[model samples]
Target: MFRKNFIMSLMENILILFIIASVFYTSQSLQTQKTIYVPQGSITNIISQLHKKGYEVSPIDRYILSFLGQPQSGWVDIGAEKLNRVDFLYKLATAKAKMEEITLIPGETALLFFEDIASTLDLDASRLQHYYDQHADYPEAGIYADTYYVPFGINEEQLIAFLLKESTGQFQKISQKIYGTYDKKQWLRILTIASIIQKEAANTEEMPLVSSVIYNRIKKGMPLQMDGTLNYGKYSHIKVTPERIRNDKSRFNTYRYKGLPPSPIGAVSFDAIIAAIKPAQTDYLYFMKNRQGTHDFTKSYRTHRRNIQKAR
Candidate 1:
């Protein structure tokens, strides 16, 4: 009889243990992903909140964190996002935050284009312009036109650093490919010529012809009487008026000055830059745009004048 009673008591204890194990398993099985936001606050408070939101925050975990260190203020995805607390913390501390992107327009002046970037990123327009001016050796012509992805909430200083690094790196790579060295003065001169090519050409297809005309004029020591040179600052336009072309005394006036401008007039495109490096091998000295939305290349002054008369 004593043996049987002992066996019954042992079975009851096993049943009770099984019940407890089942309850624990049920609770743990209910786990699901949640998007938790850990804002900037006291570390202890943050951990406590993390526990309430279903993280396995125990005294041992807290002790481990005290030795391992905690991450800075940022949103961490944990406890249901297929990541443990440790994994989430490590990523939050080390990895860059979520990214946002914007595209820089080709041929737009950095001073004006930066404002558009500022508007897109919700940054101060003046501050953006100032950053470009301060960092870029070539100012408006320094930055490469492309889509850029930056970390969310990145400050102006960080953005400027990124822009400088990328622009310099791209220039170095392309310049070496084209000219065999990163010649600062030569690169600047090429950009000066490229900027004119970028503006004068109706499209990428027309850039080479326009570039040839500029080079031809330079070789002949004839004044580059291209009206595109007058398109700058407040006077920027497609068609140069007779009054402005003749009367404008600005140094940018190719009608008055004999060679390339003091600097690039605006940001230039990749094709325009290439066109400046390798111009079409034509004897063309002048270009006049026709009604077909492209320019007509002419080798003689008489022919250019005849085309101009026909257009009128």
Candidate 2:
């Protein structure tokens, strides 16, 4: 009878353990059913927001996960994941530690860049622009130009610094690669010229050739005659008007100006910067955009005039 009682007790203990395991599994399953999105908010606020969004979470859990001696590895290990389950708070807290990303594409002006950062990263565009305008200084207008990747929650000043750092690094790399030396001052000048060429070139394929033409004209003491510069100085967009092109008194009016404009007109790409430093070795001094998105190049004034007439 004692042996029988011992067996029954062992069976009862196993049953209790099974019940406990079942409860734990159910709780975990419920947690997986919720979804949460934590914006730029404090841990407590984030938890409350998650709870309000129907997640099974508590402020204490978030506090512990975010700050209270929790291993950073555990907190951030969530990685990038979508919230498909109800127990989204834990997953979100884990995922929130993952770095968010922002991408800046080519040809993006300062205004557009700020807008994209603001919209994508939940930043204030005007405030960021103000910071850049006040703190960021380029050798010329729109000197820094390229694609940039910024992590989430970065401030205005930090973002500007990142861009400046990126520009510096890129300039150094390009200068060393192409010119065999890095000269900040001279490279800034070349970048200024490249920026203008970037705005003028009809397509990427024409950038090197257009750069060659500009170099040739400069070598011959001829006016650059870039309509894009005049358009930038007078118009809000790059679209050139006949009147603006005809009546060009602005400093950016390369048609009237004898040398490089006071500053760059727009953002330039790495290719443009490279082209500026190492222009194609050619005698071509003129280019006109055709409907095929390529330019008609000319080596002499007579041929250029004929091409212009044909373009018209």
Q: Which clashing pairs does model 1 show?
A: 33-80
Question: By lDDT, who's the top model here?
Answer: 1
Q: Encode model 1's per-residue lDDT on 203-274: one tens digit a residue.
A: 998888889989999999999887767776445444688888788898789888899888887777789889
Instruction: Identify the runs in model 2 with alpha carbons over 4 angstroms from their true place.
Output: 1-105, 137-146, 231-236, 246-248
C-alpha root-mean-square deviation, candidate 1: 6.5
Task: Report the CA-based lDDT of candidate 1 relative to the real structure.
Answer: 0.74
lDDT of each: 0.74, 0.66
lDDT of 2 at 277: 72
TM-score of each: 0.71, 0.72
**Residue-level error in angstroms, candidate 1, position 153:** 1.8
In candidate 2, clashing pairs total: 9
Tens digit of per-residue lDDT, candidate 2, span 221-270: 99998877663422536577777777768787887788887766656787
